[model samples]
Target: MATTFPQHPSTRLLRDLTHSLPMALLRTREAVVQRFRTVLSRHGLTEQQWRILRALDGRDGLEVSLLAEQCRILLPSMTGILKRMESRGLVRRDANQADGRSTLVRLTEASQTLLEQIKPEVVEVYKEIERILGKRKLEQLYALLEELEAGLLEGQS
Candidate 1:
């Protein structure tokens, strides 16, 4: 005999997962990241490392906790990532002068040169996206995403 189960009321009220905002955003993110993945792979950098490099590009240095926050990397994972980056001579860590317990991280000259080399290719990827999306639509997309983020964040506090 076959059995049937009643659906939960909350489940019935839910939107289809594919059409949900978070899922849609994630799907779009995956689609966009795929394009950049090739460029990053060619440079022997992972997406997280690229984020860290960009975060540290213009600054003197940032404390480990602050750098992790800016990079959207968890503190635990940041340790391993920074360890690998330091080993590769991409970044350096110095004791934070303000706080003896904290460390400050900065990109090394080699990583700065690598960023310079990679910038043009990365810009080309942006150009390609702009060309496909059209300038106005791309701007609108950015504005909408920013507004959505701001709105959600406002509710948190």
Candidate 2:
């Protein structure tokens, strides 16, 4: 027996999944993240945790809301991530002076030390990526991605 799928109505249009902008971006993101997923897992870190740590690595106190924005995580999700990191002694949150309602977060000494230890491995992953992608092509990819993001943002407004 043969199975067949229904066809799209003539008045409707649909984009192919392989050619979808959102799906392509998601696939590309997953592919790049897979390159470093093992290293993060070995260090007992999730991708979101690593992103938050990296964002706060060399910076001063960043407000929780701002940290969420920088990490590209939602505020509700950020709170849980912060809570877990706090339990692990990887991060600490302090009351914001100017805004009493807001709290600031920064990496703890334990995390700083862990980051120092993981720095080499992280750098190696990046070097390998550049090696495989070719430095020039990688730069161009970055530029194109930024342009695409900016264009999308502009379209929203």
Candidate 3:
């Protein structure tokens, strides 16, 4: 025979963990990112660094603050990441002409070449996702995610 503790009444009030929206989204993100992680790792880039590169791509440059916001990275962490990237010849920083107080960051020629080299693999990962999910479902997923984001943002505002 084994003794068992009684369940708390409050435990029944909470949603099941398996059905949690945030956890589901996080699980999905991790699953998807795992595929891209391999490609990023092969190119010696972290997810944050890849996000920074992608944000800067096709743009002349962006203010450090703007880049941090776009990349969803904190200002302090962005500073250190930029310093490492600059030292690695992946990025360059210059004084902002429009706003003398801010610094602007841009990808280096080497990073541009790296981006070109990595794009095919990145695209392939997207294609694989489309293949797995079916294009129609993938499009629906994108639309739903966009709608969800917009709705949440509107609620906040």
Model 3: ten consecutive residues of lowest lDDT: 14-23
What is the Cα-based TM-score of model 3? Answer: 0.93
Tens-place lDDT digits, model 2, residues 87-137 = 999999999899999999988999999999989998999999899999999
lDDT of 3 by residue, 62-115 (tens): 999999999999999999999999999999999999999999999999999999
lDDT of 1 by residue, 1-157 (tens): 9999989888988899988999999998998998888999999999999999999999999999999999899999999999999999999999999999999999999999999999999999999999999999999999999999999999999
Estimate every model's Cα lDDT from 0 to 1.
0.95, 0.92, 0.96
Sort by lDDT, best first.
3, 1, 2
RMSD, candidate 1, Å: 1.4
Q: Which segments of candidate 1 are over 4 A away from where they belong?
A: none
Q: Which candidate's lDDT is highest?
A: 3
